[model samples]
Target: MKRILFVLFCFAVTSSYSQNKISKNKKAIIASVEKHKQSLIKISDDIWALAETAFEEHQSSKILADYAESQGMTVERGVAGMPTAFVATYGSGKPVISVLGEFDALPGLSQKATPDKNPLKKGAPGHGCGHNMFGAASLGAAIAIKEQIEAGKIKGTVKFFGTPSEEKFFGKIWMVRAGLWDDVDVNISWHPSASIEADVQSSLALIDFKVEFFGQAAHASGDPWNGRSASDALELYTAGVNYYREHVKPTVRMHYHIQDGGQVVNVVPDYSRLWMRVRDTKRSGMLPVYERVMAMAEGAAILANVDYKVSLISGIYEVLPNREGGKIMQSNLELLGPIEYTDEEIAFGKGIQKATGKPEVGMDSKIKPLEPTREHPGGGSTDVGDVSWNVANINLGVTTAPKDTPWHSWAVVSCGGMSIGHKGMIYASKAMSMTMLDLFESPDLVDKVKKEYKERKGDEVYEAMIPDGPPPIDEVGN
Candidate 1:
């Protein structure tokens, strides 16, 4: 009995010591985030105000890149043929830890930083997806890790990727083609959400392409028989897609935007253009649907007697979730505890919830239990999904908006520019930076993450789904 008691006592001592050490390590990162809290908030707010879209985030990109440079990190701009994309690195050597930072805003979601749905500028761009917070928090984490490396508390290089155009073009796809993440041992990423969790679930694989129809124009009233209407082809294509939607699996999603159909009612359109997107739970599942949909475009052209062309914009793989990494992140989240809110903040959250037609649940401040990786997780697509295929990615979600508040909407835009978003940004920075400390401190942890990545990837290879040539930087701006 005495021997067993001694064993238990020794185990307790070791476990307590280990816990204390981890607490100490995390404290440093928390302090680092606090020290730079104001600057990070300013950065996030500045980007939110700029509200630049996709490849046009010149001012937003400069703010982050310049800050990185000022902090003594080597900054590389115009990376992977993207004028707004950049890479910032600090420290040197093995186990390069990369963090992704997106700064692009969505078009036509402009809103003031208020609970009410007030557009800061009507019909202008805004940070509806909280990317302004995303970029600032990620960079803050990287800088914290850099400080650790400087102080000799952690080893290995820390890299920050200033990824742009996530909303439209998936800029990381081009960066992947350029082999930007080939050598990175691990990547840490986070998104603003209505609830906090260590994200270990996959996202939708998506394909984006444009289809154009060409036909001979004729006067609708006078020479109707002579008209081979491209608009007819466009209509038929959409009809076919809608009809075929019922036959598809529940995981499949298709969307299209008609860019052109006709100039006026009096003339038959000679040209029609549309942007079509298809998505599935996996890339393998998405390809067959994409092919079938493309074939429908040809069939529609045949029916309308119009010439058609399809242009590949880009595609992205679903995220390969790393449970090993998620476990580490979950521990950090539990250690940090739930985020606290003042009465004003809670009321602000409730106001957003009400405006968005959700229960006035305010903010979900608890640390959500790390969920089991879903075989078919239902969510939107991301360029970071491509990055996950390339490197072991640890993803996190922290609440920056009211509970159940609509994403990519004015409610998100409003919260993202205020103190609500700032608090979540700081929390995410501490969580991700603490996770990075683990990767730098423990080689075994990094190996476990990479092992999970390899097992999930199996023998399949990663290939960028974008067309050959430079990213459509100039085209997207127009």
Candidate 2:
């Protein structure tokens, strides 16, 4: 009889243990995200439908702000003097985790999801970068976390940052300059891509500048030698830069195009402009070369007898990899799983690829992961690099469009408003939310990330490379 009682007691104890484990797992804050997947998909679709452009995402901002506010978050608008930038905060305490969201469309990428290329509206802007999914996924994660906090399931704050003008202007750079990320413990961000992976790499430090030359306009044939040509100055500048390229470091990249080079060849062109980008591994390394490039512009103006103006439009620092934050985000990505394409989605991706005459359905998976503390340079630039300097940040990418679908093209734009894009957005949101939960549950992780950031930063302070003045956000194009 005693042996029988012992067996029953042991069974009861095991059952109780299993039940407790289930309860604990149910309390996992990431479940909040899974529970609200449909809502996230809807939000992503709505933002895609809006299709607002950089610095002009009023509708996108409104939609995000309204949703955040509806979820009981305190919404602050017009951050850093950017009309479309905002911050939505929830929860009242320490361990602040920020999720960065970008909602900017590319110009001249208007397209509808058809087998052949077709635009919804010819010459209209479209979300070629899938920023429509970006803002929505960010808001979705924020809302889910807010729900958990309200339910007493978690203890921490979540902030959703609506950053605009990611395409043309550096919205996050301006926000960083305003010290918006100072109080945040860590930042979690992701981009829609052709795969699911944590970006454990650094991007190139970049600086955008515009050079304008002023000259007296005169009729070419009538006033023969009387006119000083700004067009002549521009040509000289281009030549000088081409010559200067050989002297600069191999890693340093410089590219530019003439924005305006006189309207008529018959007239001594009085106005000419050049837009240029200078990039390198580090801002410090890039500065001297940038100075030389500027000197080239001055020499061009001098030779042409024209007044020259150089304007620093925008700049972004290289991404500082935080081991702790990256590991946490990557583990979450593993948990969230990669984006799975449906039959229709796969067909859509293939259709876009066929239309573009690209060989693959997704980006080449050849890009390997970076070693710890080592940086891998991306050919492109992002405002997120600016935020990384101030906060413990981790970024990831999930496949959304077809492989080799050059960004800011109709091919990308066509898929941006479809299911394939929405699936990637949802996957990113789930990963971001899970990463945030890991941070909230383990404060030591946040500390470790900060320590890594400090060790990487050394004695250097993060100064804005874009100059002391604010960038002109109101300007349409650079």
Best by lDDT: 1
What number of backbone clashes does candidate 1 have, counting pairs of residues 3 or more apart or in separate chains?
0
Tens digit of lDDT per residue, candidate 1, span 362-406? 889798998878899998999899999889999999999988988
Worst 10 residues of 2 by lDDT: 362-371
Instruction: Please give, for residues 1-478, the per-residue lDDT of candidate 2 as tens digits.
Output: 9999999899677556644543342345456666767777777777776777778788889888888898799999998988889999999888999999888888777778665678888888888888888888888778777887787877989999999998876888889989999899989888877666677788788888999999999999999488999999999999989888888877799999799999987899999999998999888888888899899888999999999999888888888877677777765554444455677777777777777888745433222243465554656778888898888788877777877777777776677677777777776777777777777777898899889888887887888866676557657654
Q: Rate the local accuracy (lDDT) of all candidates.
A: 0.93, 0.80
Q: After superposition, how far is residue 283 of candidate 2 from its true place, in Å?
A: 1.1
Candidate 2: residue 317 Cα off by (Å): 0.4
Could you tell me every candidate's TM-score relative to the true structure? 0.95, 0.90
TM-score for candidate 1 = 0.95
Off by over 4 Å in 1: 1-22
